[model samples]
Target: MEKEKVVLAYSGGLDTSVILKWLENTYQYEVIAVCINVGQEEDFDAIQQKALSTGAIKSYVLDVTEEFITDYIYPTLKAGAVYEDDYLLGTSFARPLMAKKLVEIAENEGAVAIAHGATGKGNDQVRFEASVKALNPYIKLIAPWRIWDLKSREDCIEYALKNDIPIPVTKKDIYSRDNNIWHISHEGGNLEDPWNQHDDSIYKLSVSPENAPDTPAYVEIQFETGIPVAVDGVKYSPIELLTVLNEVAGAHGVGIIDIVENRLVGMKSRGVYETPGGTLLFEAHKTLEKLTLDRATMSFKKSVSEKYAQLVYDGLWFTPLKEALDQFVDSTQQCVTGAVKLKLFKGSCSAVASTSPYSLYSEDFATFGEDDVYNQQDAEGFINLFALPLTIRALMNHNKDQKNKTDKKVI
Candidate 1:
């Protein structure tokens, strides 16, 4: 008889590393560690080696950075979906792609179950499990955080030490972090307290705004159908373009947000996010849409954006509603093609100018100077019709008042 195999979503982090060993010990399953890379800055080779050394029967490190950008980030970007008006949905969207790959590996290897280190308290556990169920309804999910006696990071650290497992964090300098190309999110530690101002030492991809340069830097971005294609008139691949923007905007200390957001698990979690490139792209894209998108479309899309963000954040990516919403978003983005000039200074990114061939803003019609397009006299009829309901209500009130006065006088 052979031992049942379980595919583990390995990250070389404290939780997953511990989970890798715990799964083998508890379930007596042959563990297969699958590390899915989504543009996080980590040495995959070392992670694979670590997984193999720590009782994994086999280890796989798959690079899905390009696929992540093309499939997850771009669609979310085009939809203008920002979770809770601050988070760029970096960690949210990446989870599904990673889960998809996990399922694929599990299916290929004929694994009996999939395991993840996501805790019960956070949104990630929901994200990972929801995605797994959506992709493969029958696959068993092994979540140690929900069942195991290890209640806190401290307990997990103690377990790792006893197990002789190499862990990353100490008790003193522990901040729960999720990193990808679009953004890096920091939570836990001092950020757990809402009143504590996060120290400047936490920033990884950018400088603190206080230490940013005095001079503002201007950047030009070109978009086609709502997708960023170039920066400063230089064409680049999606990954290359984002890398370039991240470097430029990061230098100016752009895209740092601190918020106490309500989680799907019915708790509030404080997080600090750094998203320099994503911030620049979003600002530029919005400016272009203002020039190209009509008033009604823009207004309706705002509502759709909120719902879309909620769906993504809640790990409902594979649902029909999200798919339909994507279609609606794609239709609106057809005309969102243009170039925008943005100014970055001290963690602020602002769009200064934009131009589009399909722009609805016509200078000839909007000019203050006298022109053939001017029709000042036409405003009277338009205003009368627009305010007809209000005018009628006022007249009705006046007639009621007059009749009441007459009745009083007659009496």
Candidate 2:
């Protein structure tokens, strides 16, 4: 008589393959599953043989794709974190690294509780139980779609057709996707209709800016202190430089979006996403941080990239203010090194040129055919010391309107 181990973050789909046989027929619990690849073009030996043919006394898959591109997509692409600025949080920082590898395989399988299949209406069940209560606050967490009786995806596809269990998904194209290598979202059927549009056969990883490639491609990239290794000049290693910029920006359709967001569980969903090579590495690291930041550190890193994209889209990735906003985004990526040069087209990508050897752009102090670093009459003593407080508030509103016109002629 022995049966009580849990673990499960499995993903052979159809809701963790019917929550791995509904957590062993509703709580007899022995499931072990894992599966934290992070690059999501799965097969992984058929999802670890369908998690040991759907009962999972044990089954992992852990590739961590170069520790998910050097610890969560290069510190959220060196903290230019996006989210509401159109999400590149990519499944919000890959569900806190798949809940820290399901609490490290439930503390190496002594497992007492860790299930997940994230669905009590989504934000990935608070990003997989707040990253397993911020990395093991004494494990125990199971979720079974917030306590199951299988109340939906068509009653868990009729309880995986009465537990014969080989599911993928049906009921005519159930969307709810979530791939990796940087992005692929989608979200429930007809993208939960915010005026239902999404259907160019739900374009997996791209191709539908009116069926792309009519021409226009460019693509240069390079970066360093701010990550991305190389593309055109060809260096590639962070997973072959994002798989050759997601196959040349998904053949020109360049990262699709389609938002409607706002869902830290307060609801307002409607997704779509795609992010072909994380939109050409976030437009070549924001055009090499506008040729190496500065303008008050690029306006205080745009409010620390919107509070680091709302604390990594609200999962709060192992806190302490996201480790002091990743040390202020690694001191603004040192000198954000550079290269840029983008183009893409069809769905438009832009940033068509940038250089940076710490460039603060100087074309000889921005010339209009001028010469000696100008002092054109020193701009009238710097516009009278920058309009000295608007000329002393317009001479104190003209001496309070001439003392109300000499007290209205002595009343």
Candidate 3:
């Protein structure tokens, strides 16, 4: 009889590399490693070779960068879903796409089980398993960190050394990182301590603000239906546009965030993220929304944005709530078409100018000088009617207080 097969999500990192070897030894199963490239700057050939040498029966590198930007990143960008007012959902958004591809490969290769390197704690496990269950419920999930005795990054390193498995990380530099086209997130090591300041050497995608350029850089971004289409009057594809912005904004140290966030596993984790391109796009999109969307719609959308951020952070991407939220978000983007000029200085991006054909802002009605569009005298009646309840309540309170004073005098 043929041996059972398990497809493992391999990253050629310390944990997953060790898990690849352990799965083969412990279960005596054929371990096929699948590495999905979602714009993480890595050599696919080298990672594939490393996986195969470390006891993987076979290895596959799937390039899904285009799909990642067009489908996952763009939709999240349009929704304005920033997790905890800082994180751009970099790691949160990548998991579902990776899980989707993992299920596809499992079905194609006739594998019975899929495995991941996510620890017992953290949101990645939830994101991975939730996606797998949504796509292929019958497939068994083999999470090594939860089931195996090897605990902590140190234990995994020791296991790798004992088993003669080649590992990429060392004990001294054991920062757990996740990178993509959008951003790079750094956790663990000194970052685990919330009070400790992040060393500047940790940032990979952006420069230190202290070393940023003295002069501010000005750029114009064009958007259509809430999607960024061009930069500095040059039209490019979504991926190309972001790539250019990353270089320009990164030079000025624009998008670096250090925060202690609540993890989905009932613990707090500190992380530093660099998101130059994502930061620029978010600012540009928001500027356009302010011009096109009405006050009421924008206010309601703020509420929706918060819920959307929570859903993405909790790894609930492949659910009905997310889909419904997306529908509502899509409807609001119909008139969000415009161009915004932004000034990028050391660690800050501000809108300098914005214009749109669909803008709700009318200069004629809002002018300080005399204007026929809006009557200045109409404000008195509007204010009186609007404050009727307050006016009546104040009068009633005064009358009661006067009656009390008279009663006290009689006593």
**Top-TM-score candidate index:** 1
lDDT tens string, model 3, 233-344?
Answer: 9999877898999999899999999998999989998999999999999999999999999999999999999999999888888999999999999999999999999999
**Candidate 2 TM-score versus the reference:** 0.37
Candidate models: Cα lDDT each: 0.92, 0.84, 0.92
Q: Each prediction's Cα RMSD? A: 1.4, 19.3, 1.6
For candidate 2, what is the lDDT?
0.84
TM-score of 1: 0.97
For model 3, what is the alpha-carbon lDDT of residue 261? Answer: 92
Every model's TM-score: 0.97, 0.37, 0.96
Error of 3 at 155 (Å): 3.7
Error of 1 at 182 (Å): 0.7
Task: Put the candidates in TM-score order, highest first.
Answer: 1, 3, 2
- Flag clash pairs in model 1: none
* TM-score-better candidate, 1 vs 2: 1
Model 1 spans > 4 angstroms off: 168-172
